[model samples]
Target: MPGRRARRRPVGDALAGTGRFTCGVPEAVGVKRPSLDAVRGFDRAVYVVAVGQLINVFGSGLVYPFATVHFHLQVGIALAVVGLGLGARSVTTAAGTAVGGYLADSVGRKPVMVSSMALSAVALASFAFVPALAAAVPPGVAAAAGVSRVGVAFVGVCVASGFVAGLYTPASSAMTADLTDAEARDRGYALLKFTNNVGFGAGFVAGGVLYSLASVSVFLLDGATSAVVAVVLLLYVPRSDVGGDEEADADVDSSAESGASLARWWAAATQPRVLALAAINLGIAVMYAQMQTTVPIVAKEGLGLTAAQLGTLYVLNPLTIVLLQIPLVDAVAVWRRTRGLALSAAFWAVSMVVAWAADVGVGPVAVGVALVGGHLVFRTVGEILHSPLASSLMSSLGTDAERGTQLSVLEMAKRVGIGLGSFFGGLFFDYGLSTAWWGVLVVVCLGVAAALLLFERSVTPRENGAFGDATES
Candidate 1:
């Protein structure tokens, strides 16, 4: 035993070492806790990718908040048509995420990321010309184009941009996972989240001002940012960050020998732990989706808040996340990820209950706005706790060979959940069940919290091996 070299623990084993199956304890004496300093020691590529993502998401924020307004009001496209375009984009984006994951594992992360960004730049730039293109067509021809040429062109742009955006997600995530070791991965993701929120919050404020002066210029600016990010990622991020090539290729070859690409995807997708994680994440995603889809509507229509007040509410989420994400990451680092996720769900459940009270008029209009603000703050806590831990957990679930696919599955689940939440949130409002909707989500969040605890109990033994039997030192 004296002469033998010690084997390194697997990522799952390292994760399990915090405690034995139940909620995790703090790290043992002398174990280095995760911190901002640890993040500084991460690979150069991690910072590169984070910078690129910040740039890209800022560009997205410039367009995302205004896309419906531009199309439905300024461009004279029907609201229904604009909604259809967004729905189509969601569908295409989901499909692209699956395709992107496969390509990330197969070709490489860098190529997929760069190409997706380039395509997204082109698609976004093309939005500036849609009004002109629609104008060029005669009235008859526009009618024949289905809800006017603007609708057609807008949908086309949405689909193209959404798919490319989707493609970027898994590739970028996998690249980050490749760059950081398991210990540093959580902070690495938190850093990325911080940058993304800062960029997006800034862009949202800027876009609000610029959209009034020269709306077309906003689209062009967004496109320019995407192009800048594309160039940065291309020139800076090393090709080696593509990652898992030899192992991925061997996996492809093995799958090829046994079955088709679909089969290969199915095999990866069907892993019990991956599915379990995805299912849990779906509930979380649905809870989050309500903020984007339902909260503003309730604040405006139900509580009589002005446009500016609603905007402030919308802004609060990213602001909170940008300020607190890193410190929170350090605070939670010693706990088992599942415990963090469960706490996140509890926070979400409380937020939903608060939201219900606000909708039902807990007091004066001022009180309603205050309640809504509290809702956003609580929801932001859940988001901060969930995002990095979920990403880290998903990353740990797969071997090098199928990590991309594994992350992709998680992305797909989020996409589906968001779509479902938006649909159901709207449906309930339309059916005069707005107050009931919050109650329903409260139950969902609590159920998810309980489920996460159970999931942790079941999976700990398999993940940690002998470590599962031992408490934290």
Candidate 2:
């Protein structure tokens, strides 16, 4: 076959905490050579995928903001029930993502993706019944225990969502690779983040509405919408992009001669770069997760932000990405990739330092303004620095056949970090803000160190700008 069809010059970058090449947009649209098309070419495909992700993430965001309120206020769950539900869901989600990554790598992206969404639908649907169960709580039940029952249900949904994540994430990442070359990976992933951000915003607003009216029904509504998304994806998302069914031929290190062991699964998930990717992602998760707890605490108690002002924080982060990530990616593409990574680390360090200072004792207004503004600049800068390079790196490193699996692993690591960080950070923030801020310091500092590891001339920039140095797809 003639060397892959002569392609167009890649579009220079910017995206949601990511960026990518924009070559095919003009040609695909019957336009002539490069004229700085605005998210036109391959960007179109990136946005399409965003639509699906938007739906999925919106559902997630909707549930997150209100689950507690639903269980306690409307359903009358005890405090212990709330804790159990949160903890159980976190663990279950982590487990699901890990297993799901293996499934994506070993089985096929489509199967996992399809399965995950269906499971999420089932799990989310089940949550609708929580109100009914809570209504039956005995008068003398441990308030916390009644809450625990609610927690158990949440845990159940989380476990099922694990299956959803296992199925959806791998396929989703692989699809990023499928639709574009290495050059476009950053933009593709950035688009993914943008979709998520927008979804989250929409969800937050919708959730406030749902919960103020009736919390449990939000789950029911979210579940129904997600089921619709799954069907559409099943109908449209290409299976080959996720992976082919080749696991039957792969070796299975059956352990303890046990029926339910994960020996084979672990073997697959531990593939090279998976752990390194996870470590870096773990740091990101820690930083990212604080939005719900730690970051907001710093925002409110430290900075004196009202709910409306707090909402502005979200606007700054995503809006910047929407406007700047692609251009930033294009610019970084000209410099050393590691330099971008380093810059990203610095941005994180600054953002945290700013927030920490405010939280610890900086004047409330000054800290608040600095924290929000600093966060906007730093996060935007960080996204430009890390998004394209990291994603492209993963694209470069993973085997063509297993690219989706690699993406799944990266996502899995993030979930793991989020779970652990949420609990730890929550306790610190709730029990003591100063101590919690310390934890943030340690994590952000480590993020800087992780960036240094990416140095060393051995690392080469791929045709695509992403995280790992995987072979081009």
Candidate 3:
């Protein structure tokens, strides 16, 4: 089998008097470099696409959390009803992303991406009218009394909106990878994630305010912003002239994929190296999900904290992520990938234990307790370390054109992990005292084990031209 080509070495080539390495294509945002002029303005495109992402995701940050609460209480919607709505939206998003991922492979990353964003705009645009829709109901609903059916109907609207978001991620991630070179990949992805978190934090606060004044306010704002995002993306996002990363002349075995090397995609997915990365992603996302869901439950019920206090802890994370990600990213960038993941998982284990004790010494007053403070630092640190690495590895999955589908599949794996993890964890935790913390501990441990397993098992595999250059099996 053909193997990955040796890495691009500008210095060595220059010393040897080889012009091939001396005058190469310019570097793209997330990739190491590009060989095509079509991909010339990749950096600007990322920002434009990011606008659409932020517009949709900011609304997601606010509405997803609020919908459950609103439906379960304010709308007097049954718990089953709320669960079904949430689950339906999740399935919709998953299906949409899966389809979009394939389309990215078949057609091209840009058209699939821009088209999805446009549809997303339509979905969000409908949200602005939710208030008027709610008003048509009985006085109990319009009056904003407890548990209005009208409010539940609006939650249904949000469910539809979330489906569109699901379709957008894989295409966007693929486009980012397509536009850049290997070296810049991590930074580009980190920047995108940073923007997402910043938007999330602001939206969280804004959602509460908007929802209180008019349940539809958040939707209206989100919808309009999505429209603006679509416009920006259309004007600024690069066209198909831009292709994916440059192929390595040596290791390319282009028989596996369709337009892509199908065998290459197969090798990366099945190979120990790529599979290990997938496992690690699954483990990390599981732990991450618990922080929002289980950890809070333990704090509120077991430790006895008021809703406001618990909420403060939740809100603190977004601000903390935005501030620390830059330095953390830089620091991790200095280390080899293995060292970063090991250090990250080690700290993550500590965060789980911290939750076990957050309520320990505080007695009845939730005010004085700070058990979770340490966990915040650890969680953020772990996230900062893992995110860039994950992005880098996933971006290395396929050539430029196939990047979205490959990455999208990886994302789907992550979502599957998160979905099952939360489901099982919820079942396990609701059974006993401090049960969730213990479960989290178990999950973190499993992540560490998987990371180590991958590290131990990595072996290079034959791949297509572009991906073969930047990544090994």
Highest-scoring model, lDDT: 1
Q: What tens-digit string does per-residue lDDT give for candidate 3 at 292-370?
A: 4456555555665544444455556667767766556543443345556667777777777776666354444443246
- Candidate 1, 305-351: lDDT as tens digits: 54444555666777998878887876666567888889999999999
What are the clashing pairs of model 1?
Answer: none
lDDT of each prediction vs. the true structure? 0.75, 0.58, 0.57
Winner by TM-score: 1
Q: TM-score each candidate.
A: 0.81, 0.74, 0.70
Model 3's C-alpha root-mean-square deviation from the true structure amounts to 9.1
Model 2 deviation from native, Cα RMSD in Å: 7.0
TM-score-based ranking = 1, 2, 3
Answer with 1 or 2, whichever has the higher lDDT: 1
> Over 4 Å off in model 3, which ranges?
1-42, 76-92, 121-162, 242-273, 295-312, 359-362, 367-369, 372-374, 429-437, 444-446, 459-473
**Per-residue alpha-carbon lDDT of model 2 for 1-473, expressed as tens digits?**
01221134633433221322234221121111222442445634345567877887777766664554455445665433443455455556666766665666556666676677777777777788764554455545535454354454555565565555555766667766666655455555665766676776677666656655665666777777678777867777555523545444546655542233245445445765556655676676665554554565566556665444555555566566655665565555534445666667667667666666656666658656766667656756776557556666666665666566566677666666666656666566545555456556556756655644663234444532333233323
